[model samples]
Target: MKDELLIKFLLKETNAREDSEVTEWLAAGAANQRYFSQMELIWNVSKQLAVTSTVDEDAAWNKFKENAGQLDVQRPRVRMFPGKFLKAAAALLLALGAWSAYILLRPGYTTIESAATVRTEILPDGSEITLNKNASLSYQTRFSGNRRNIKLNKGEVFFKVAPDRKKPFVIASGNTTVTVVGTSFNVKYRNDQTEVIVETGIVKVRNGDNEVLLHAGERALAGKGINLAAQKNPDQLYQFYRSRVFIAHNTPLSRIVEVLNENYDARIRVADPEKAALEITTTLNDENLDHILEILALTLKLTVVKEGDEIILK
Candidate 1:
């Protein structure tokens, strides 16, 4: 790319064809991406300086000419172009315009993701969410005028919504929709099922014609081709990801392995499907994987085998 065209691109003064070219260049390689980032930083810094400093371009030009004359005397062999000075001044103005246009024309939504560990975030409406690993949540940049909406793209998320009677907080997860006002709840969407566990206040969960209203200490499970059902959640074991305490009350061994695999990225399998069907009652707190595995093997009367990164129980 030519220096002149690059300057124009940085200033957002490019035509449609030039803009497409710039986009292609940015996508070409990491080096081009880095160059554009540096240029954007410079443009932003220039905007900040323009806001804080009173610049008199005419006075600055006169001062520059004065300094240029002394430099010319020191290096008499060098030649100067009059158009170069005007181009430099134009570039400075273009940088300022670029920053203004970027703020106005850019369209984006807030997206949060958790990769290897759980993440917690607060939204514009003061709602809080704790995202499990590999989970993502996205919403519009603006959440105002009687509604706050977000989409749970993948994995589980625990929401604590701020009370807003006039404006409702809605979350769309797969085929199900969870609505609430001033409530705290956990919504997990996996394997074609959406599970909602209410921690406080009230929540309305819906899937097609099926719907259920849940209160504190209650939970609802919904899936395709099935109705939503509300039940008493006696054990708060689901919150173990955040509370560091795992409490299991007749929880299936398969369920335990599922939770462990989700959080720890471990590969654990039962030798027999019947073994996983067995339920166990136990409480583990901040325990290592091996220790927890040992306890499960002992309590369930199973043999634990370790091969490479995989764990198998028989």
Candidate 2:
């Protein structure tokens, strides 16, 4: 069979007559079937490599020849075909070599960044991660070997990890490391500090020599001059990016304003220090900045004033 016809058949682009011809050719002998299988593998691998990086065909051929020489002693005997078939087989071996080289030379981590809005990623092991705005995360493209490891380069990220006790899901955020078998949690790395909040299942946060295990509804803070310890999660504000709702359960005005500024890019502050301590329990759905501010003002019975570029409440 011609290489073009075989390639078209491999790609499923062949017409009915061509398909019949290729099917009949494969049925003729095991060697023909093996040749077609080799071509199919080469086509798939080359297509994948084409998207990622440029392939050096000459180098790949050379690598394939070198490896083929080593395997010749153990290689199975097959009837030889025309020079064109040999050339096609060489191309197949070349692609296989290129794929191997690509895997070996590729960077260890595939980094992902969120610019102005939240981003979601599903990992190879079925773990899901939601990155907050300006957040960065990195992980191996293929989860090989034992562990499923990830790095929270900066900003906040929530993880809903798939269960795999044998291969634990681990994340590195700044100096802290979080380890879990199957769990959902949030990790925020900002201002040289790493904070972890567990929403479901159990999470282990480690900083330097100190480590703390946190359960659902618990959190931990790790940074310079900070003791690593699990504490009760204050509010559901951490999930605002994912849920699109700012939930305050008797949350302080100061804390609420801080999150609002982070989420909406709004400069909101409590003018009176006493008012900053005032607590409010409310769920603010994602809406316009002005509308959210209006709700906050009404709930706190405070006046909202626009002074320069800042919004102040008293």
Candidate 3:
């Protein structure tokens, strides 16, 4: 593959055909993959280093040269292929320094991940995002050009986007793309499906060519073979992560159990299939798992049984 084409691919400026060409070239051999990886590392590292306004390029180059000399002196093994090693090192240095200017002008992504608990973050554009447990979100470190783009890799997140009429806030999750201007919404992406619930302003959820505009109290689900349409949000259970409370209004026991299993460490199940259809109307505050189970058992006249790691309700 041509160096120009690979550079274009790295910069995401390639067309579909060019992209396919690079992909085919990369899959040809391990040497191609390693070469690409090295180039990618240099591009990423140079961009990171260029972000610092106080970076002294000349001083850094001198320091690296000094370190290289010391490594050669300390490790005699590198002397076996001194010509190849030195040539590679010289090429890396040239590539890094040359790309520093170009990479510095481009926008890079910053990723935020929530491990076992919900995490709140404020973006560079002053937008607030609360990520549920095990959720991953990535956005540009600096909102540039025409839009603020965010990617939801997995799990659920609530976005309180700041108003920017010129630059719309866009979130790409699975096959769904949500576009909004100054809106608060909850997005849950899981099992190949993406659900969007709008709380404040209007949100546009698009899957493939179909799109739905959702207002406050409205939501839409997009997935394989699922129609993109707005519907009234049935319950406020989506707010459980942010509010630390589960408020179910005539919700099925099965749905409640699903949410509980998601939030708690204990596994909950309905032993009787018929009992799973039982409706429950209650507000479960920040109570412990056992207490919540006890409340459910008392309300439904069901028996709570503990069998190993599972909590069974019959």
Candidate 4:
């Protein structure tokens, strides 16, 4: 009975048992001594303006506004005032303190916009990102206090995260969870499997029961099932994230098609696995997809047809 009450009070979230625990804890003369002492500390901290607003990146100020468009400006959706007394015990509050995170810092879950074929961008917290092709990434603006989390369901992006001894950046896509304190790396999770390439950073990839750490120039491959692939790199795996390539040398046809679709919105499908598995060893210089496709057809000697956004190859 005492344990559950303590937990809820700590979290500041309430339930029926709360009243019972308070009565019991207070009824015991010695227990009241501890409880009131702790409450005094909490109220004192709340009274200090500096301590109340002193959320320094690590505390994760996840206070949301009603419309939730802006934080700290006062809105109906805002969960509750830090100044308000949350009816939680020390332990529960301490546990929730870990969850004290900020949203994407921007109004709406942050929207990463780019019009260049290749561009480098930075987040509100000084994290660097490189966008390739026509990729759009969106995340929360209030990312500091409660959750330093971002969701990616498509495209390829490389990140060079700053060291915040306090908060960590979390990237979630499908079942792939990439957690980092301070690291530089790249990820391409547009397809079935998440392809992560770390350039110079300490990154941990969690997929199901597997938790692998990438030191530098390492690659971790994750997918739908249990067979997770973790490969080390001398230099080859990170070659793409190393320089950012719009083209590949002797790249498989399947990979090429996927790249074109994501990069230029050119949907090309190789109906034959025999043809899709074929490797193309040529440079795709500044030419458009049509020009590149024409060159491939002539060189590979394969039948090609484009219908709407679909390209069928036999």
Candidate 5:
């Protein structure tokens, strides 16, 4: 394969796990490091080209025409104008146009998620994130390196950051910047306030004007400036999240069903009079839809099925 194709494959497959190998490869020798540096420069310049820049619908077509005319002259040589190269360039341009149209027509997508519970998100680095109830998070596909980047729209997020020391794990919400080498942490930034409490290892929370190093068992609240103090309850530091069990302890049936549905990915409702009247208490410790439904069935004596991920109860 060509050098460009190798780099493209690596770029597409880039993730936190690959970071270690890349770092090691970079440090293998000065030549390898130089190659990476050049590639990064190219990547940076390519991104700034803004092939998918958004503009008014009428203005966009005019701009595209102008942009196309401004392109450099293409050589007739097959090597310079290969069939594969033309196809790839055409595909890339089409994708860019589609992206611009999507941004122009759908303004709501300009919004990140809001007030979500147990949101499973895939990051640009292929790392998965799960935001808990009343949680919110957002991100831009384009971001600076040196870390995985995310903007917490609102609410809280539990991060299982893929390990990438070169690019530190960073969460920005309000004025707080939760920075970690490579670890798990929960950040809650709703309303105008921000809360960050680390679970494992350590994370540093820095506000717009304040950057303070925070250790494990440390929580930070950022508003106006970063206010970080040692966690008052160090013993049960992360009990609420660590339990991972959606326990509707004496909670109303209607509310409990909603919580269960949101958390365990179930769509169960009180189907019968007996089930509705029964105020059952159960724990869902990382239970899937089927497992949770089965437990609920045993608890409430209801029927469940294996209709893919969806749980339809009666």
Candidate 6:
């Protein structure tokens, strides 16, 4: 145990195990026992000092000042700068100010807003972003000198980032940060969880020191305190929101409906929880909602009932 921890044990502040550990350490050798005895003596002396408050603060300060003055202390003298040096300093300061202003107002940002509709936008670096409804992507116009950085303000976005080995692309959403040199990935910010699904290339997702690398068909979750966990992506249903095509390979019904609800304005609710686990392998490409629902109802032996805005599957 450390001296500080042993001090805590000496004060009866530590638990039984800590006390025993300190006791065993003290009993190991004469040096250890001597160290503990000295510390104990100091502790007892400190307790006496705490009880007796007879020391004069101002008198001690004055005594120290007198003693300090008796000892010779060297002090450095300040030198004056020449006229030419002052002029150069002024010019340097002015140049620095101009540079600061240029950096502050650097080319501004290009913001693409996809409000209630899926939209695609090409970034300045030739990277493509397919944004979901209510999602917005904003990045600097000039990515030449600066990092290829983008911010997902709300909702989800699929990024097909162009390869820039020197300048890595970084996407920041809430506390989560996804960095890549060149990659295609889906980043979704939902219910305080930032999910990263990599379609191609490699992505490094970090929330502080808790970071995880994700490759193609791999997914990761980044959050506070390094809850870095990655696994094989369960499905690629997130792409449906941007592609208008839902491809399922032995996917569960519950998982399909979850993606469907996010893609369409209307909500798709599975009435029976037990049937959600049923595996389905199908491709939905530009199919009408009514037709797709009809097919799903027939295949799964479930009834599809529409009540107002919500579609209920029983």
Error of 5 at 282 (Å): 14
For model 6, what is the error of residue 244's alpha carbon versus the real structure, in angstroms, after optimal superposition? 2.5
Report how far off residue 90 is in candidate 3 (Å).
27
Candidate 2 vs candidate 4: the lDDT winner is 2
| Cα lDDT tens digits for candidate 5, 1-314 | 12343244345644565556566776777655554554455344435544543434334434434443322222234443334433433343354664442232221212346354456676766666776766666664533334456778876577777777777767778766787767777777767787777667778887776766656667667787435555532333233444665665554455555656645546566656565656666655666656766776787677865456555555
lDDT of 3: 0.78
- Supply candidate 5's per-residue lDDT for 210: 71
TM-score of each: 0.63, 0.66, 0.67, 0.56, 0.42, 0.65
Runs of candidate 5 exceeding 4 Å displacement: 1-116, 142-144, 232-242, 246-314
The model with the greatest TM-score is 3
The sequence of per-residue lDDT tens digits that candidate 2 reaches over residues 1-314 is 66567766665667899889999999998766765676576656555445444344445456664543311122212332333333454455565554563343332567999999899999889999999999999996656446777888899999999999988888987788999999999999999899899999999988999988999999999998999998999889999989998788889999989998988888888889999999988876777788878988888899999999999898
Better of 1 and 4 by lDDT: 1
TM-score of the candidate numbered 4? 0.56
- In the range 92-180, model 1's lDDT, one tens digit per residue, is 54544534433332223589999878899988778888998888898645563345777888888899899998778888888899988
Q: Residue-wise lDDT of candidate 3 within 73-148, one digit each (tens)? A: 2221332323333344334455555344224333567899999989999999899999999999999765655778
Error of 4 at 43 (Å): 13
Error of 5 at 140 (Å): 3.1
Q: Which candidate is the best by lDDT?
A: 3
Higher-ranked by TM-score: 4 or 6: 6
Give per-residue lDDT, candidate 4, residue 278. 85
Of 1 and 4, the candidate ahead on TM-score is 1
Root-mean-square deviation per candidate: 16.8, 10.8, 16.0, 14.3, 15.0, 23.2
Q: Which scores better on TM-score, 3 or 4?
A: 3
Q: Could you give candidate 4's per-residue lDDT for residues 1-314 as a string of tens digits? A: 23234434554665667766666677787535454455445444544433344333212322223222223332212243332333222222343343231121223466675555766788878888887665577765646343467776576788888787667888887898999988888887766678788878788899888888887877888987756666874333233423534455667778877666656666678888888888877654456677877877887787788688688876
What C-alpha lDDT do the candidate models reach, one value each? Answer: 0.74, 0.78, 0.78, 0.62, 0.56, 0.72
Task: Itemize residue pairs with steric clashes in candidate 2.
Answer: none
Off by over 4 Å in 4: 1-109, 113-119, 132-148, 164-167, 190-193, 215-217, 232-245
Between 1 and 5, whose lDDT is larger? 1
lDDT of 4 at 200: 84
Worst ten-residue run, lDDT, model 5? 101-110
